[model samples]
Target: DQQVKQNSPSLSVQEGRISILNCDYTNSMFDYFLWYKKYPAEGPTFLISISSIKDKNEDGRFTVFLNKSAKHLSLHIVPSQPGDSAVYFCATQRGGSEKLVFGKGTKLTVNP
Candidate 1:
């Protein structure tokens, strides 16, 4: 089946700390991986992405690592800020199109 899994429904961290979110997939055909962040009443916005050919990708305070052999991926946010408090969704796409299969989502809370 085409299922993306986010094991933890929520994570709490103090400001200026690092926040890590994990995702897993059962389908081997998934070649593109992406992370999206969402605020209340808003659609998810793309955070970071990595292709199956790459092991790591980073953008500013966000970094995404993909372990293709393990079919696992993770998103890391450094010096987590109050602005980072939101729902994070992990998504994967098959080789054909960019359509995504999303996880339930992980809520990240950054304490002041």
Candidate 2:
């Protein structure tokens, strides 16, 4: 089953603009949602995350919003910078589980 999906394969944004990445999941039992950024040939790095119990979580310029009703989650990057360019993956894990399920990925490019 395709539990997680990223509709957009790529997104482009100009520096100093907002960048939004979207993700959808079919599993309601998922307790946590995470967004990871990966550079080419490099391992994915944790970007931001949100819990199912919370509607929104923010850290600096990155914010994650979760809508349990629609089973949707999105990551918002404000004033996107050139350094923010990378492939983004959406992931989820249920309670008491160590395994993480990830979507294919969405490549983000920020142009100066």
Candidate 3:
């Protein structure tokens, strides 16, 4: 059983619209949460991350929100483009640990 989970298997969003993805976890030891985007046949690429001590982190068109009390988090991509279509995985890193525990992932399709 994985500690990180993405309940939604897939998401569809129109281009230039906002896309939101959700994730949940059961591990309290995780001190950092990250979102990774992966294209077919390629490795996951880091999208955005948030520290457990903070509630939100934003970068360019990506934003990550953390809710420690609820053990939940979300990723938001504004003005999503067709190139944004990919599988997004929610992952966590334990304090002082380099290993990352990843969720099954949710496939996001950005329609043009």
Candidate 4:
């Protein structure tokens, strides 16, 4: 069974708009939530993350919010740009585990 899920396979947004990507998980024991962005023909790169203990974490225009009670998390990008277009994956890891479970990914297109 897939532990993490990205309901939307793709999303489109106009340039400079705020983009929101959603993720859900079945495992409540996940201690960390991570978001990765992948460009074409490249490996996914770490984007933002939030610990289960915290509700939100932010870096530049990227922010990740975790809702433990709902087993849900979201990644938000403000002023979304064309360069931000990529496949975004939602991942989770346990406190002491190196193994990461990732969602299939959501393709984001920021139209210029």
Candidate 5:
């Protein structure tokens, strides 16, 4: 089963706070991991990604950490803004292709 799991259905945080989203996977063959941010009815857009070989990757206010041994990963957004309120999906790519298997998604609400 190629399933990525995001246990939390939603998260709420105050502005300028940190928003952390967690995800888990059962497949060990997955080598690439990605995080996508979505708003409303629009499609998810790429946020950040980390390979199995690395433990941490960061881009500006977004950071993603991966732990292959535990088959877990997390996304951290520091100083969250109102604009950060959206659905965050954790995805994984198996083998070589870029096709991704997504989690249920976590809705992040950053209150101003």
Candidate 6:
């Protein structure tokens, strides 16, 4: 059973625009939301994360928003660049657990 889902398999955005990637989870026990970016031939790298208690977290041009009541989360990138093009994975982790449950991922393509 897929606990986490990225409904949109792919999203395309113009360079210098905003990119939004969405995810939903069925497990309410998850207390952490993690976003990972993976380029071709490379492993997924941690991009941004948010705690269940927090509604939003921002790092540089990336921001993650969590809606615990909806079990939904989104990652937004402002002024998206070509380098931002990658497969984004949405992961959920329960408090104190090292295990991460990941969604299939959404491919983001930023055109210049």
Model 2: per-residue Cα lDDT at residue 99? 94
Q: lDDT tens digits, residues 1-88, model 5?
A: 5489999999999999999999999999999999999999898999999999999999999999999999999999998999999999
Who wins the lDDT comparison?
6
Model 3: runs farther than 4 Å from truth?
A: none
State each candidate's clash count.
Answer: 0, 0, 0, 0, 0, 0
> Per-residue lDDT of 83-112 in model 6, one digit per residue for the tens?
999999999999889999999999999999
Taking all chains together, each candidate's TM-score versus the true structure is 0.96, 0.98, 0.96, 0.98, 0.96, 0.98
Q: lDDT for model 2, on a 0 to 1 scale?
A: 0.96
**Alpha-carbon local distance difference test for all models:** 0.96, 0.96, 0.95, 0.96, 0.95, 0.97
Name the lDDT value of residue 49 in candidate 3.
90
lDDT of 3 by residue, 33-103 (tens): 99999999999998889998899999999999999999999999998999999999999999999999999
- Angstrom error at residue 76, model 1: 0.3
User: How high a TM-score does candidate 4 get?
Assistant: 0.98
Give the per-residue Cα lDDT of candidate 3 at 41: 95
lDDT of 1 by residue, 15-78 (tens): 9999999999999999999999999999999999999999999999999999988999999999
Model 2: per-residue Cα lDDT at residue 44 = 99
Residue 34 in candidate 6, Cα distance off native in Å: 0.5
RMSD of each: 1.0, 0.6, 0.8, 0.6, 1.1, 0.6
The C-alpha stretches of model 2 lying farther than 4 A from their native spots are none
Please identify model 4 stretches exceeding 4 Å from their true place: none
Angstrom error at residue 30, model 3: 0.8
